[model samples]
Target: MPELPEGKVTQGIAIATAAAFFLLWIAGWLDVASLKGGFIPARVSGLVQVPGAVPVWLTPLSATLVHAGLLHIGFNLLMFVFVGRFVESVIGGGASLILYIVGAYAAALLHWSMDPTSTVPMVGASGAISATFGAYALFFGRDRTRGIGPLSGYAVRVLWLASAWIFVQALIGMAALGGVQVAIFAHIGGFVAGLALARPLLLWRYRKA
Candidate 1:
């Protein structure tokens, strides 16, 4: 495992993001912020008017910084600290940031495709964190397949793990939606983006090194 200090840029971003979410909640601006910053498929698709001054195109990025509640932010930040730090340590902060942003956009695009007319706002860092998990799995999953059947190679193992993860996410999404809506497609999109980007980033990192 890569050892990242507390003050690493990627870690700082994760902490700062969590702090921002808490601050918004404390200030009673979470609702307003979500309204303006959360990713809304209808807004992106131009089927609905944006409520605030922020541009619709920017919501996908901004939405990543917002969270629905304490549990949402807590889980995201925990994953960010654990998975993101390692990814950043391996690939460097720039690549980590790029992965996060790209993952968020990818998540938004997938969610929009799945439900373009939905009025509910989508907000969370799960997609970005899922991207980190994808990269992590690509880098470290082969050795960790303890119970799973033997795989042909690293790629196949990673695919198996990803498939299992997606299945779990689907189950979680169904349960979450039963109480409060969750964007399961966003998680899938982010994980896919991370999986797609990880090898290239690793190659680039190696070349640069």
Candidate 2:
């Protein structure tokens, strides 16, 4: 495994990334007309019916870095600040970056699979963050998990919590019920990638020790 960079370095990079995204979002919002290139090409173009051809502008690789609007950016950044710190602290900097990219790509792949004709270019770090959430649940737990609710004395194993969450997401994703289009699949993809990637590193460390 690569020698991952320590805390501050990775944190700084993450902060800078968030900042750039914010600036881009602001610029796009201020100029509304420029929104064409901003990230909503799929929404703008009726080309959503295209087969397998992702707009060059909205490639899965670049989608994570883009955002739909200020609200979108704000929500994603907040989650990043909250979950990213602990995740980075536990996993090394390099690994965290890898998780972000892998999660984002995995989420996009899943989305593409579901909506092959959707020229609707998906954007935002939600997919990556969702992956982080998955990894966190695996490394940590649901009850001890803060922010969702009052952190009293909730302690559920990672696997159990993760399974339950997945079930909930499935129920919500069903749409026939009341769940909205929240990209639950992206979260799942990111999570699976995190578990798959993080497991080996964790196991290796245990063996080394």
Best by lDDT: 1
lDDT of 2 at 201: 53
Local distance difference test, each candidate = 0.81, 0.59
Candidates in order, TM-scores: namely 0.88, 0.65
Candidate 2 achieves a global lDDT of: 0.59
Cα lDDT, model 2, residue 63: 59
Look at candidate 2 and tell me the lDDT of residue 5: 30
Q: Please, what are the lDDT tens digits per residue for candidate 2 over residues 1-209?
A: 33433456346645765675777766654233223322233443444433343355355445565665566667777777666666677776667777777777777666656655554345667777777766666665535543334432332244455577678767766763222256666667776666666655556445656
Instruction: Show where candidate 1 strays beyond 4 Å.
Output: 1-7, 144-155
Candidate 1 lDDT over 15-127, as tens digits, reads: 77888898899999988888888988888778888645369888888898888888888878877888787787778787888898898898888889998998888998888
Residue 59 of model 2: what lDDT?
53
